[model samples]
Target: MGAAWETSRRTVLRGGVALAALAATAGTAFAKPAGRRLPFLLDMVQNNPGEPLFSSRFNDPATLKSYGYDGQVINEFIPPQTAITFDSFDQRIFPAGSEGRAWVEAAAKKIDAHIARAHAAGIAAYIFTDIIVLPKRLVELYGEQILDSKGRISFDRPLTQQIHRLMLSEICARFPGLDGIVVRTGETYVQNVPFHTGNNPITNGAASHLTLLGILRDEMCVRANKRVFYRTWSTGSDKLTSDPDFYRQVTDQVETHEKLVFSIKHTEKDFWRTIPFNRTIGVGKHRQIIEVECQREYEGKGAFPNYVIDGVVNGFEEFRTPSRTGPIGLAEVVDNPIIAGIWTWSRGGGWRGPYLQNELWCDLNTWVIARWTRDTSLGEEGAFTEYATTRLGLRGEQVRRFRRLALLSAAAVLRGHYSVVHPMGRLMWTRDQFLGGSDKDLTSDYAAIVAKGRVEPVLAEKALAARMWDEIVALSGTIPLRDHADRTYLRVSARYGQSWHRVVHHGWEVMLRGYAGDQNGRYDKAAMRYHLARYDAEWQRWQRLAKTEPSCATLYQPYSFGPKGPDGLYNADPDHGIKPATDHYRKLLSS
Candidate 1:
């Protein structure tokens, strides 16, 4: 439960979002026209006020009229997997009678209306049903009385297939034009009246449940041409971010199926520390690259408004992570690495109150309209986020930072050897198994791979090194040796240091030498030559990276990196495995 998603669950389910209800609407209102924008985004949560896809925030007539929303991402589409027993965890025993069908029906209707309204408003909306969170519908199908030798519910039962098929069919049939579904990697299931709170959990493993979900995404969602969005979360079990190989495995695996969008979510803690790792992946699959912001699991929900780190700001528009606060992540991370837009959670608190500024509905409208229109100037006219702090609040700053970061992060991406993305800042945790991990390797290398069966998250650092120095060399604006400072804004800034990148390349070289050994003394000679060559060429490459890398890292410390955990395959409870990886990352930084 990366930050409990600010469950205004009580507010939403009980009284519904009343932000707009409390505002005045008697006067004639005229909304400003939306500008040309590309990326479309929306919040997915339960009981979000405002009509379905719309937000119940920003009721001011001027602001209200100007804003338009993209979509509604419904929470807990999960067929509850709450285990009556631990060993029977992955068993898909949930039946598809009233509860099953009704769950889908209710969610679909809610989304159907949301999307319809957005479409009607000339805006598009997407829906994300937690493939993991729905009632462990598996148990319902298997019958509560059944259990295997280990007293575990069995996924082998026929009821599992029935539930899967039923849920899949309902998903496609329900929302035809959904923008996409964020296929997370866990189960934070819902509780029914009869079920005990003990049945509820903060996190579920990335195992059979997630695998079933993967099957759903690839077989059903992908086949239906539905977009599959993955929030990379394997850092807990696997050192995905540090080891380029591990991160690549995931990208390749996920890319093999569906038109996918990936939100790389492990950088908030270190700020601009992760971009270099991202650029290395070369934007595989052309996946809509999403950077994560507002670490839900770490930071107290709505307790504060944390800004996107300064160093990473440069790369946002070029290689951006999505933001949940009222920040303008949408305007920042564009393509160099494509910015897939941003995700603003809670809208200053939907159920309990609000998370940032506006309500859920208003947030949708403001973000979607701004993004679709791609107009940064709109907010100055009172069209961006609902609650305007200073003249240019966080949203404005985000937009400006996004633009600047895009210029720099891309410059860095162009000239550097890796791209790091920031996911969220906070570290979130729930009691029990969801917080699973074992520190096996000194590198804290962890793995939560559920390919064949079991799932586990470990602490390991993984990185995606960009070939900007090679592949993106051409994009670097060749800078005249002197007065480069003036040209810094031209997608190239000497301020973006290449020290860490050199270290990575040097590490690779040395590690290679380790394999080569000092055999015949030739190994030492060869290593020396390689070292010398790199040493001599280092400064030149730094200039090149400075020129081509995105401006994002320049906004904060260049300690960019990446992390993966249960979220990679399981998507739910994304931050579960980041601690160990962070430990490794800190180790590297300390070194």
Candidate 2:
């Protein structure tokens, strides 16, 4: 039965590829072809329960085609069990009469319908799944065999391999329409899947990763004739994802095949500014896809204007150094044949809550990147102009003015959120959906800045960011857009950004003064009090704007300096060594 299925799947894949190529040839004659240099322009969409439009807009076929994306990655946390059929081996893991089993069966049908829609639209669909996810009952039945001496889930264990093979085979058989499987090996979240648990299967590092990749390459690529988009995101678990040399070490060991492609983020690390470009891209023999996050979770989550086109298409000027190799931006690699695609995360990254009512910011970045990927000649400014003229109906000076506003907004974000003078060394002041100004993260960052005697410069940068935001607000009002609602949104969002940057500036000032006073042994009570008052006033003003403007993103509490904050960065009283001023500020708030 398995042999016959494999034979039939190979035949279908050949026919599908040939038909797709012919269709592409025919379609290109009429319209500009997409994925010219980068053959796979894909975007991933996950469910945002709070924002239904987030997923719906991205998943819409018209939206995908309009954006020039030839493929879509459905990574809505759809578990492997959803596609796996129950057999004797599976029954042992997920015994009959289990609620999870029933749920999986129903979810599979929904997934089938979703894939069919993608196929109907001529968009290739790939399902995303974490490796080594199994029913909780599997541990109860086979814990000893599954676990290593250190109690970590062992990937090399016979039982684990057997289950991995079974899951891959079942998914391929059940969903023959799937073009590939996107494998994330770094982290696993079993919180949503009550009945299932997952862990990184490559516990033993490169060798183990090699073993797993070999299995996937053979099973998915060779047998099933499907692609395997092996994501090189290890979340800092070894240098497999970040270090170019380390990445090559692991990938070079694997036998290269046309069906096996490496998906890497544009940054060497997770999506953040100030990090160098991922040098692993265009390296080695395997095809590669550069991952870009349009919404920018760490920056603003599309809550404010945080344009990334200039930085992404042209290397960020901030991070450029003399010793860098190859090109720092995606546009530079357009001619590289090994660079096969661009994968975009239009929305959804980091934790929730600066939920957006207006996707204008996200849409701007997504549309430009998508269009540029199709035609590399668009560049950054060209693409922005096109978007302005074609989408926003701006012409002449209006387009130029909007571009200036966007550039200023992007600059403001970098200065406000990151250290402009210093190489952002391990200081996470803001992340994902939340901004922390008075927290220990910022405190530590300020302490380092103060110690380096760069406090004044940092403050100057912050003030400049605040001023640029003011300019952004002013410029936004002058540019009369075709869409009045969009114009209002840009104006209001810029106002919110102005207020937010003021809060950041004042918040950092408070921390810098506290740290500098502690270092110099001369505490300035008057300065501290003034900055604290300013911070509070700005935060309140930002909150008021947030309440009035629907497009304004939800604000993060800037002064929540309590015990047990994110990553234990605030275990100690954040107000503790920087006292009297903070104490007075706390009292003022309480009163």
Candidate 3:
């Protein structure tokens, strides 16, 4: 509520820089590659499973032991029983008003300094902010007022509108460095119910919040001209599809004539998420309104096994292997959904804190592979955050069962059934072992069947990101000549870099579920143990591939014909390449 509590992240960031320098002194560093794949910013969020995810950057050490993440807590409802209700984090996420000049100025200082440093380092920075509600000034005038049929504000809607204008002006004025704001889940609960906002359940908010959310969104984009993002679906996720009318009414209102960057958290093509409709929305129309599909967040947070992106099979059918979608089909959908960018809510986004190990924040190669690709991932560090933030609020058996369930889910996906999965957020394993029959017993269970889910056919791993990327040396086709480091598209897509990475500790619980039919801890268990070792070796091999292979790069591919756009072919603007962007990530310690 006041500036007194606000501390510019700059000083804290400096301390982190000093600490990272020390780490470098001890020989911890990323391998500088010759040429990196470009076109997206790998915005990595600070995540760890079974613990609270945090913003641990430079000052704090990156490791898996310090943070036990409790994964992202989405609406994991059991249906009409567990529908996602709404609650306002107006209190928790934003303590007071961010509109006040002092706090605004301070926040601006932190955002700008970080962005400036990012620019110097060769990485392009896009400051991401949460949905910050307006102050009393705006609300006092517009107590949920509206515009008349003539598009004229009645009693007080215009007053509220003016407040938005002022608010947006402040935003634009304060953070030119900020690329956009990631608006948290805003609407969709017509009837109030109980749900967890990051694991802490609370009474759902009134329907008015949704209206206000729409208004905020509309005003932010229309007036401010700043990019706004919001997550639509989550666990037990069919609400949006069930009430498509309401969904259309609300989203249409916000995105009209504006570049609304909608990052749906639905990692699958199941009944619970968007039906690959993005291709239709911007296909042959305006590509600004694009949909980003993620590798399912819950089913293992990419921590389960090796994964790959095969491109869209079909927008409507069960998500399938890339090739199945028809060669030059949706992949070459004559320009429908270029599939936009990806938001890796994998480690977080569930009621569980973060799903991956904490040390992953510092896992250089993992990020290298990710960043080298032209795709957008989420981020955790804010230029200067260096502390334990994302954490696990779970306990004892609950954690155990969660892991067990996850294991079962992994097996199910491997077997081509719906584990904790759908197509958008699908999984991929090595060819040899994937077909080795380890998952041969995966029959579609009745519960998983007859639901809004379906398992995919055996994955075809014939694809590779390295070859795929190199194949695109030319767009539609033409090679891009990029030179500027300060401006590039990829910088806006990734969530990585020592400056932006977050570290949290998470453990791998490989119980003796052992081999097939090893239900009990008995003689069958012996065989289970023997096979468990094999699984370990295989798991490592897969993990290594994710770390070192081309699959990881392709995991978040954001393809475009070239740097500018369809019209920029003749524009005299200079094109920038990948190295300038990569240099941006390591700016803090770079000279």
**How many residue pairs collide in each prediction?**
159, 0, 73
List the global CA lDDT of all models: 0.34, 0.72, 0.28
**For residues 383-417, what per-residue lDDT tens digits would candidate 1 score against the true structure?**
32332223123444544332332233333332222
Any runs in candidate 2 off by more than 4 Å, and if so which?
1-36, 47-56, 320-326, 437-439, 559-591
Worst lDDT 10-window in candidate 2? 25-34
- Misplaced by over 4 Å in model 3 are 1-109, 122-124, 127-160, 187-225, 229-284, 288-296, 306-347, 353-591
Best by lDDT: 2
The residue pairs that clash in candidate 2, if any, are none
Instruction: Go through the candidates in order and give the C-alpha RMSD of each one to the true structure.
Output: 19.6, 13.7, 22.3
lDDT of 1: 0.34
lDDT of 2 by residue, 161-263 (tens): 7777777888887888888888888877554556666677778889888989988998999999999999998765678787878888888899889999999
TM-score of each: 0.42, 0.87, 0.39
